[model samples]
Target: MKSIIKKIFLLLPLVLAWTACNDYPIDEDGLLITTRSECYVSSFELLGTDQRSVIVDVATVDTVAQEIHAEVNFGTDLHALWPQFTLVTDAKLEPKVTGFVDFSDLDNPRQWTVVSGNRKVRKTYTVYLTVQEP
Candidate 1:
């Protein structure tokens, strides 16, 4: 009985360490593929305009460290386009905006602008990311 108890105690640490080192595979919804890389843009919104607040719906994949571009068009004709805008995320991250654009040079639509508010906006645009299982 003493030898059996000694053997069990000796094996306990190895068993626990093996279990801790084991990583299980995962399965989730909206998972594109099982790979070491993935990128996407989740949601985008337009805030603070002379007309009204608007949200743009987008669904697409993006590569890591690459810019997730978006084009916003406000259906209002302003004499001089001057509207402050920002992109807010549902995540705990702070709101970010690309440097405001000067659309005064191009006159074609009611309102058309790019997402160049200030700095390079980086956030998990895609919500509920499906990280592929290893």
Candidate 2:
């Protein structure tokens, strides 16, 4: 019985080590790594200075064209507005959108790039905002 107990203890580390070895990869976020190449903005939102939505209706996201269009109420301040974007799973955005950004210039749209989780695909998106007529 003592010999059996010693053998069990001796093999326990090996068993644990074997179980620790994994064939699958994990990302920094602890998510299982995948080879998905999909990269696009699924949704877009703009917030006013008061932290309220400035969009007149749902923002339009054109994946094929890689463009986003949003209409804000007339007189809405675009000089300091916050943008929020929802992207495909495991995708990342460049120049990560964090705080307020200037969208007052209608001619020059803002551009952001989306990179796939596997780093296999990249898409640059242009964001356009227009003010509704009072």
Candidate 3:
């Protein structure tokens, strides 16, 4: 009985290590195939007209509702050049916007095409930004 107990104790580490290993497959090019995540903008920040950088206070992603909410500082003071906003996403997006965003119209929503790392999945996200004027 003591020998059996010792064997069980010796095998416990092997069992635990096996259970903790993830079975992600790597391609011939040594790229992880299953580590890619869904495409979505994770965060957004803007350099306001006053030359102050401020992060969008409410950039939230609602996957269940398939929508994104963003807020920008749009006081009456910021009426000259449009504040340049930067967006970072989970995955690379195609047809990327090269220049700064011109926030002239405050109503229309913008769209982007998000492509997965494997190029097998594509998703669209509609970004709606609201101006918080006070």
How close is every model to the real structure, measured as TM-score? Answer: 0.25, 0.77, 0.52
Least accurate 10 contiguous residues by lDDT in model 1? 125-134
Q: Alpha-carbon error at 133 in model 2, in Å?
A: 0.5
Tell me the spans in candidate 3 whose CA falls farther than 4 Å from its real position.
1-37, 49-56, 76-90
**Residue 107 in model 1: shift from native, Å?**
18
- All candidates' lDDT scores? 0.35, 0.89, 0.56
Q: What TM-score would candidate 3 get against the native?
A: 0.52
Question: Given candidate 1, what's the lDDT at residue 71?
Answer: 38
Name the lDDT value of residue 107 in candidate 1. Answer: 31
Q: Which pairs clash in model 3?
A: none
Which segments of candidate 1 are over 4 A away from where they belong?
24-54, 57-134
Q: Give candidate 3's error at residue 128 in angstroms.
A: 1.0
The full ranking of all candidates by lDDT, starting with the best, is 2, 3, 1
**The CA-based lDDT of model 3 is what?**
0.56
After the best TM-score superposition of candidate 2, give how far the Cα of residue 78 lies from its true spot, in angstroms.
0.7
- Residue-wise C-alpha lDDT for candidate 2, range 18-59, written one tens digit per residue: 776654566565655568899999999999878899999989
Top TM-score model: 2
40-61, model 3: which lDDT tens digit per residue?
A: 5555444555656544464666
Better of 2 and 3 by lDDT: 2
Candidate 3, residue 84: lDDT: 29
